[model samples]
Target: MRIATGDDPFVVEILPETPSTNAVLAQRARQGAPEGLVVVTEHQTAGRGRLDRTWETPLHSALTFSVLLRPPAEQVPAERWPWLPLLAGLAVTTALREEGYAAGVKWPNDVLVAGADGDRKVCGILVERIEAATGSTSGPGPAAVVGIGINTSLTAEELPVPTATSLAIESGGLVDRTAVLRHVLRVLFEHYADWVADSESLRPAYVRASATLGREVRAELPGGGTLVGTATAVDATGRLVVTTPQGDRVVGAGDVVHLRPAR
Candidate 1:
């Protein structure tokens, strides 16, 4: 896919390969790099997914990149900063649907297609807050590095696990990586800018594209345990509301596995 000849959407820096684009940008942000800077590498050897898990992809077969965003503190509350990853997830999910893959997010921001076994992940989002050195959450509101990885051409054999998938695997062949990346970035940036401007609910669109909601799920809660229930809804604050036998619980962080209801 060809990037058009015109004003670039963001300042993009491309490398043949790298250990991790997020790592590169994190160091840059510490040195006072301005926002709108992006780093993309053809291959990532030490890429990290949520929960510190390693993310690996074939060289040149995916869009492995990170973009920096310094949302104006006055506009976006620090507590609401969690929406960045969700925003990125929604962007990728919409992009895939446009490409004819039935894509949706599995809470927070794991992009996947529903399958007989479970949701087969095609992308993962990791949003890191750029915190103050004094270990305080104050000051410049919130800075974030949004890392997105999309598998464009990985075959079934190349998938890291049976639960993982790719556009090639799902679409039956290679997709235009450049085209996919362009569309996703466009979608993410636009939605982000709109949110920063209006501070409204992105939850509606997010809820619509979420495969997690309305399903019986088993969530691996952060502190060490599990919560079993049906994902009833995603609240305005982006929390997953699960209706368990105990009560309605709002999950802020966890690994959710969509489960098939017992027959």
Candidate 2:
């Protein structure tokens, strides 16, 4: 597929290959890239996730991009940083639904779709912050990069897991990757602007699109332990509230797997 170009509002840069769109954009932001600068690459050699997990993508088969946003100084609280990924997931789901697929968010960042027997992950989001060089921080510095990856036309054979799916697979045919990417960006910008104005309104849409709440899930924590619980709710700051065997616990980060009730 040929890389297309347009004189859009945001500075959209398309490349054939990059180590990772997030890393590249972060570097540019450190050097003062303007807000809303979008970097997209056809292939990512060193794509990474939140915990440095490997993110592989086939050449020209998926949407691998990152958007840079520099919020005003001390405008957003550090605790609410997770909202970036949450909002991005919502945008992806909304874009897919507009393209005629049932899309839902698997808490924190993964975007899932209903497969034949269960839900399958179709997209992943990662948000990263750039610190200042002064060695002392009092407020927001440069910008934050929200990186997104969406499976557009990957066949079943190309999927990393049996339960994972692509837009093409879910929609019964090939999907236009460019169209999907453009729509997602548009939705993200609109919602992000509203969030900057007033983040409270995003809660309803996020809660409605979330798949973790009201489900039995096993959360894999960062330090080497697991918590099995029923996801009860998502707090205003976007943390998952899980009712566990011991008690109710708030999970800030984890891999959540939905469980099936015993017969």
Query: Which one wins on lDDT?
Result: 2
Model 2 misplacement above 4 A: 1-9, 134-140, 254-263
Q: Write the per-residue lDDT of candidate 1 for residues 104-163, one digit (tens) a residue.
A: 987878899866676788898888887545564544434698999988888878888888
Estimate the TM-score for candidate 2. 0.89
Off by over 4 Å in 1: 1-5, 115-118, 132-142, 254-263
The stretch of ten residues in a row with the least summed lDDT in candidate 1 is: 254-263
TM-score against truth, every candidate: 0.89, 0.89
Candidate 1 scores a C-alpha RMSD against the true structure in Å of 3.4
For candidate 2, the lDDT comes to 0.80
Over the stretch 81-138, how does candidate 2's per-residue lDDT look in tens digits?
7677888888888888877888888887789997668888899888888865466454
lDDT of 2 at 60: 76
